[model samples]
Target: MTVTLAQAINRGIHDAMEADDRVLMFGEDVGKLGGVFRVTDTLQETFGTDRVYDTPLAESGIIGTAIGLAMYGFRPVAEMQFDGFAYPAFEQFTSHLAKMRNRSRGRVKLPVTVRIPFGGGIGAVEHHSESPETYWAHTAGLKVVSPGTVADGYAMTRAAIAADDPVIVLEPKRRYWMKDDLELPVTTEPLHKAVVRRPGTDVTVVAYGPMLKTAMEAADAAEEEGWSLEVVDLRSLSPIDTDTLVASLQRTGRMVVVHEAAQSLGPAAEIAARMQQEAFYHLEAPILRATGYDTPYPPAMLEEFWLPDVDRILDRVEEALDY
Candidate 1:
């Protein structure tokens, strides 16, 4: 079946709720509105108000409620509505959502999933377009995962809901409309395992979420230039699949990391550090990063320049190959 990324997420949530009565969803405008992107369409009508409902426009309150519900043994999937909007709930996320199990000495497990629509390229106004994955990925006790394809969106969402610890699902807003032909309830790799999207022998291009598509395009273009670019999608960001990444690097002998987030202390930096430590001997060049500038997300018109695109990614690949 052909399904868009948004539809895949909706079906994933619907299936999870149907399978587990404890899996409940609540967030701003998620009920009747079906989310800003309509990703939750038809869920409320199917499950009624109790299982699927709406909440006030309070990110902190939404996350707080999810934590409380999770403690009560309910697998709560909370939505932040947009990327920047999640900032209001940072305190709740870092202090409570990410530390509950440790604080309780492993007795209390918070099976909470916070679904955040993140990244740019839709040309929305301020606060609507942002990539805040690094914030959650940097926090301990929090599992951060993002899906680049329809299959992973479904499988990863189910995985997040079933997890004993809290998980942050960063949906690439730009890729929401991207479609693929695949049956429902499809399970791909594990939540934290990185998959090689395109195999190559020259350089490895690592990306996740919105940037995955861009990296793939770069790989195709690189082929015309006689460079084989292996693309690896980092499905799980927090507990990164270093094994997969190291294996790819060992094969390619060069690497370039890409993301929509700022370059400073971003996921790319962490991956580069790990690759150096684990597979330094196999590296042909210093791992380079093609990412957003170390500045705030620019206005809608300037986003094309701000976000990492195919040209920028290929530039990094060329530089890595030169080394």
Candidate 2:
């Protein structure tokens, strides 16, 4: 029950593979290398090479093959080597996999999951730490989900594998090693529900994936400064859990959306618009967003200034409280 975020994800994938004979996993370095982070190690030995294997250095081929496999009644889980690498597969995803269900008039479904390691931290090189969840979420037929905790990572993988639609699982690469104390039997929730990570009446800090940890840290730091900050992990990014967030905003009267993606038309923009439409009268100040710079993720040295951290989140929280 007590596992690091990375182990939880690995265990989740193993569970899905064991439960379904039709489930297959393929990605660069996945079979022999066990993934660049060792998340898929030992899978090929356990599941057989046919079920777990590696692909060439082509993102489009990975996705295109996965789509074909899904059409043949297999649930394919394809991993994009890095956030930037997924760009080449966008056509296959948005044009083919994402539209299959709708294009088939709901007669056929593409039960495939695309796993992309995204977001910055750990002093990563360029493209390895890019946050590109917004791009996938923008696709209509794709269901986008990001895990903010070990339990979410485990449960959502199972849920996504079972769904009858294409799903994009965005793993926060930076939080892969962040250890935590998990409960036995696993604290589980719906795949589309937002989790109230920290409860307070003052203000709500909404984040998913990597930014949830920062928001929680900011909440802890804010407590020391006598500000009770509520942190909500927006688990489902595309079909966002607006009902849960609307309740939080009504109670807190202020909201801050935090993410590592650029500020424009990102998840924050969608959440802010939802909040403004649903809880306009309850808000004490305009919904705020604490996110990465509009520019690309900088080098290891400058990424510190670009990514949203505890200090930056707290600064925005204070500004919202003042307003």
Candidate 3:
């Protein structure tokens, strides 16, 4: 059955709650309000207020307490109302939840899933459009992932809940309304690997979150101009799907890394570095980057220039091919 990406998340969590009595969720207004974006609508009622409850607006406290609950054998799913609000919990996440099992020499485990609604496009005020994936990806012990499609939204949520380690799942806020008949087999692909959304031969465009949709659109725009673009949705960000990325670059000999993060030290930089190390000889040009400028995400009025649109991606593509 076809469903919007947002609905998939709603249904998927419902399934997870039914599948495991130990699963619980906590966040700001996740109870009666179902979250700031309504992703958790009705979750509290169905799961009972005890299983799905709201917590104080302190991110650190939410995560720190969730870690303890995890130690007690409860699967905790913590939600950050917005991407920018996750900073306060960073210390607790990296220091405790991420290191519990390793510190115990594998004696104990922390099973936690943190759902963050992120990325731009809805056009809101400050602190609403920040992309902080790099900060968490830089963390050592946490598994970071994002879902670009309804199918992935469901599968990744389920997989994260079952993992005995802490996982951060960033849901592209701009894509909640996007829907599709993602009836693909459940076992078709690994949640931690990259997925090829489009096949091509000219160049490889690596993107994640909402940028995945933009990359697909860019591929279509270039198709008429005789350029074939292989669009790869980097589903898993932390343990990057480097193997898939390297193989694709080896074949294309050109690459364009796109993301909504600032240019310096962004995911694009990491990808560019890897491609250079693994496929420098095979490259036809320098790895082109189409990224958010090295400035804070501006007001919605200026985001068109900040976020890489089709024009931006294709402009870089031209430079790469012309090189």
Candidate 4:
């Protein structure tokens, strides 16, 4: 069936709730309103208010409640509504949700999934569009995963919900309506493994979430220019499938990292450092980054200039090939 990224995620949540009565979903407007994006539509009606309900307009409280429910053996799935809003709950994520397992010396398990709609492309307001995955990826005890396609959206959401450890699912809000035809209950690679979306030999472009689409577009453009570009989707950010990345780099011999987040201290930086450390001899040129500037997310009108696009990605790819 043809399913959109948003609908795929809704089905994933629905299936999880159906399979496990212990699974619960709650967030602002998630119950009756079905979420601002309608990703949670019909869930409340299907499961009723007992398991699927709405919470106050407090990000911290939502996360805190999820943590408590998790401690009590309930696998709570909390939604942060937007990317920037998750900052208010950073304390709960780092100090409590992430540390609980270790603090209890392996006796406590927090099977909590925090869903965040992230990235900039919908011409949203400042706080509405922000890439905060870096913060969650940097946290030690959390698993971070993002899906670029409709199938991965459903598969990754299910994996995140079933994981015993805390997980942060970064949904690419810009691609919510992006659709594809696929069967239900689709399962791909393991949650932490990266996959090569397009194979090429000239250079490897590594990206995830919203940037995956941009990278694939760049690869298509590069083919017309006589450059074979390999696009790798880093599905899981925290654990980072380094082996897959290194193998791609060894074959391609050149690499360019792309992301919507600011270049400084972003996921690109970590990937570049790891590639150099593990496969420096295989690199044909210095790792280049096509990303946003260090400045805060630009206003809606100026976001076009701030966010990375196919042109920027190709520019970096050309530079890498030229070297």
lDDT tens digits, residue span 142-210, model 2: 999999998887788778888888999999888888787656445588888898988998999999998
How many collisions between residues are there in candidate 3? 0
Clash count of each predicted structure: 0, 0, 0, 0
Write one digit per residue (lDDT tens) for candidate 4, span 1-323.
99899999999999999999999999999999999999999999999999999998999999999989998989999999999999999899999988899999999999999999999999998799899888889988999999998999999999999999999999999999999976965869999999999999999999999999989998988889999999999999989999999999999999999999999999999999999999999988999999999999999999999999999999999899889
What does each candidate score in C-alpha RMSD? 0.7, 1.1, 1.3, 0.7
TM-score of 4: 0.99
Per-residue alpha-carbon lDDT of model 3 for 1-323, expressed as tens digits?
Answer: 88888878877787889999999988999999988878888999898999999999899999999998998889999999899999999899889888888999999888999999988878978899989999888888899998888888888888888888789999999899898875644553676899888888998999988899999999999998889999989999888988899888888999999998888998889999998998789899999899999898899998887888999999998898899
- Which whole-number lDDT from 0 to 100 does residue 130 have in model 4? 94
Better of 1 and 2 by lDDT: 1
What's the TM-score of every candidate structure? 0.99, 0.98, 0.97, 0.99
The worst-scoring run of ten residues by lDDT in candidate 1 lies at 181-190
Question: Which parts of model 1 have CA positions greater than 4 angstroms off?
Answer: none
Error (Å) of candidate 1 at residue 120 is 0.7
Q: Flag clash pairs in model 1.
A: none
List the global CA lDDT of all models: 0.93, 0.89, 0.89, 0.94
Give a tens-digit lDDT track for model 1, residues 1-323. 99899999998999999999999999999999898899999999999999899998889999999999988889999999999999999999999999989999999999999999999999999989888888999999999999998898899999888888899999999999999976854869888899999999999999999999999999999999999999999999989999999999999999999999999999999999999999989999999999999999999999999999999999999899888
| Local lDDT at 206 for model 2 | 97
